[model samples]
Target: MYPSSALGEFLRSRRARLQPEELGLPGGVRRRRVAGLRREELAPLAGVSVGYYIRLEQGQAPNVSDEVLDALARTLRLDADERRHLHRLARIPQAQTSLPPTEVLRPGLSHMVEAFTDAPAIAVGRRGDILAWNPLAHALLAPHWPVMPTGRPPNFVRIDFLELAFARSLYADWAAKARDDVAYLQVSVSNFPGDEQLLAFIAELKELSPEFRELWAEHPVSNCATIAREYRHPQVGAMTLAAELLRPPDDEGQGVTVFQAEPGSVSQDRLRRLAELTSGSAA
Candidate 1:
């Protein structure tokens, strides 16, 4: 079929938002019957025939040309992210027979995590899969989990949005923080086109929340080098933490993210106390 379910949904979403009147076409002087502009209307707007547009929409078009895709993008007035998504869906190659696990932490990177003894540090792949995390990192991040799973990868993006108590309780600047996190993840997705896992994760998020779909369409980018975050520590109360993202040497495919509270501040005090409470809990 088409690369994934996301393609049909993406096109339909765009098509459902346009109007013939908006395209400078006659509104037929009669009431419109369709929810959005019909395929025939879009074909003329995109400078393509209705039959061809129908084939494209129905997932029957094979090896769709970039020029035609660009024409459709222009006609739809797609934003940068939506245009990129269109291109991605149309061009995603077949999955490899033996695709390797994208998450793997290097030794030197592991050492860096250890070096940040007091800071909460985590190593994540391009797809946001947590490959490794330091002790304090676990303490800063894991309070959200109802029960910590043994030796399993935790998806940071999923926990942020899906976990009700965690998003509401732990994160203080929740909306802004969520947007930044999603923007960062989008950048990673853009960097690695045709990564099946990344594509599937984006598809999953798109289905899970309309807000995410809207944000993803905006195509924001965040480097994650530094961020201001507020965390409510069950033990020490609320603390604002400065998040840091570190990319190791070229050989390492993963990046390390550390959250540190300002020294001598209330957040610092809370982080220290919380760290003490979970001292030996790291598995």
Candidate 2:
């Protein structure tokens, strides 16, 4: 994908969400044609000419200065992550190397997951593929799905958005979770624009799921670190868990995710029972 196109889309999406009155601009009595601040209105507030802003929005502006980018970022109320993404898109190189290779869990990392008998911990690759998981995590996340062979990884995005019916049943707030997954994928794309496999996965999702396509078009980006998720496990009934995402020190795109419940809470009790059940079955 062209960086210019990505930058333009991101800018336009951000602009469309801001109301004119939010920036202290007067809302005229006449109905506005566009949803948010018009291009003309945004240009002056961002300290740039209307023609230049138009060119920038149309992906025709070249050699955009830092001052102008910062001005536009401020005008659009971009957060730190969004600002970084903006910079990455605007400073694209003519040639980009392929994404780094898929990460495998170190022996120590694998042992760590084995040690977490009660909690659910899993390692995932950049493309949302499950790299490694303990029995508890496997039981919690994909009890009903068929297991892939040893070297092959199961993609969470495909299961959640396209093929698996159990995914809808797994998450209590399916829509919100689905959107977060898409947004996370969006951020990953900005980081690795040259990954053909990643691009193909995105294309397949767009063709398979209308919801995924709609969410992808919004250009939402995030680095999800902590989240409270509710899951309705087939064996455990209902439980709310806190998910913590950790990137290994040596790995850039791979992450280790752990799920836990409050001590002595009902959810924790349920988790204990679920773990026992999985352990018993494994033996």
Candidate 3:
């Protein structure tokens, strides 16, 4: 079966996440069979006709003006990234998603990643495939895998959901990480609406993992470029690192994520120990 239209699904999910009471709607939040503001309620608040809003939500409205979308965004109380996503869904033409032919990290970027010898760094492709990583990154992220991966590469989504034992053991807050992964995937889907392959990727994940299925249905969208992550390394104990996702100016589809701890902090010391331990083990 075909997936629901991304535009329509996104709108419905956003609407369902909001509550009448939160928006200070009249009638004092009576119990209802349906959740969130109904089309009739939302339309007036967004300064559009109920029928028109319904049409937009159903993906029937075409060439919708930015002013109207902005009104909808404001009324929905969408965050900056979400507002941008809504605009893209309303205004951009449908196109198939295309990724680079090679999964190899760019030469310059790979060098940069390696230059972060003290910190953990990884390069990933658009679809979450791990392209390259430094030794510390290898030890920190996926010690279960080879130093240089062969055959199938490690993936962010697969590693987080499919490798439950490892993920649960590794992250201090596995639930938060799951949300981040699913939301980032939504960002990818929104970037390329009507992409069958991307839809299939979602379908496969849903089929395999109930948690992923539930989160995917929630339709959360986030573009987290930097986040403080807590890692419970089996070898070196607990540490917190700021993971910064950097995309090259020339390439939007690939990113280098560097993990570094605050100077003079306990986490920084643990990270150093991890680097030494991993290197010694390899030696």
Candidate 4:
């Protein structure tokens, strides 16, 4: 979808989730063709002309003022992240949709990922594609799929959705993790609105997984960083791993994320065992 299309879709979806009664309107779902407030109701509340608001929703409005956007954001109950997404879709210049070259692993970062023997560390490209990973990360995240000699890299979003059985076995809260995967993609797209390759990738995944389609339509917004990953590891039983996301100053939509088990915790012990198993096999 184009940036305007994304903008329109986002506005429509957010409005659909709200009820007229919630805003102290008299209708109470009366005379309402849809579930949410109508354009007329929203326009007046946000201090804009009804025609202008309609144009904005349809992506026909060439320009929108920040004051208006702020009002609309407030009316729609948008969070900080969602508000940022709204602004970008409305104002930021669109990046070229042509597929860029394959993402290369930066030198020091690849070494950095490999250096983390005690924890799961990975170099993550856009949309959570695995660029480089240490042995523990390999064992922790995608043990079933052996590392490819050469091909498209393994993407965590695709794995989290299409590989349902494995994901469920890995994450204690599989449903939340699946939703988070979708949301991360949503946030990433704000950087390259209407990117053909990225859009096609997401569209294909949505087609492949019904669960993904359901979550994608919700338009959840979040970055890839996770506070904790509650793992139900088949080998080590259970582990609650904390994450630290590393984005360099010259970030090009790539970063390193490490998952660590707290020192002296049972999770740390299990992680050590997992590490031994992964490294010993390699040796």
After superposition, candidate 4 runs with Cα above 4 Å error: 27-31, 92-101
Candidate 2 clashing pairs, residues 3+ apart or interchain: none
Spell out the clash pairs found in candidate 3. Answer: none
How much is 107 displaced in model 2, in angstroms? Answer: 5.5
Which scores higher on TM-score, 1 or 2? 2
Candidate with the larger TM-score of 1 and 4: 4
Which lDDT tens digits does candidate 1 get at residues 1-283?
2244445556776877877788887768777675677888888878889998877776677688999899999988887766776786676554634235555668777787778877788878777767777767777787554333656478787777666567667787777877886876765654455566777887888799776777776555456668887787666788898888888657233788888778889888778887777785643
* lDDT string, candidate 2, 1-283, tens digits: 6454888888888988999899999988998877888898899999999999989877787688888999999999999878888887777664778864554656766676677777999877677888778888889988755444455577778879876478889999998888888877877777777776777788889999998999988888777788899999888889999989888777556777899998989999999999989889988
Q: Pairing residues by index, what is the TM-score of model 1?
A: 0.63
From the highest TM-score down, the ranking of the candidates is 3, 4, 2, 1
TM-score, structure 4 vs. true = 0.92
Give the residue spans of candidate 3 off by over 4 A.
Answer: 1-4, 28-30, 95-104, 194-196
Clashes of 2: 0
Clashes of each: 1, 0, 0, 0
* lDDT for each candidate structure: 0.72, 0.82, 0.82, 0.82
Which RMSD does model 2 reach against the true structure? 2.3
User: Candidate 2, TM-score vs. the true structure?
Assistant: 0.90
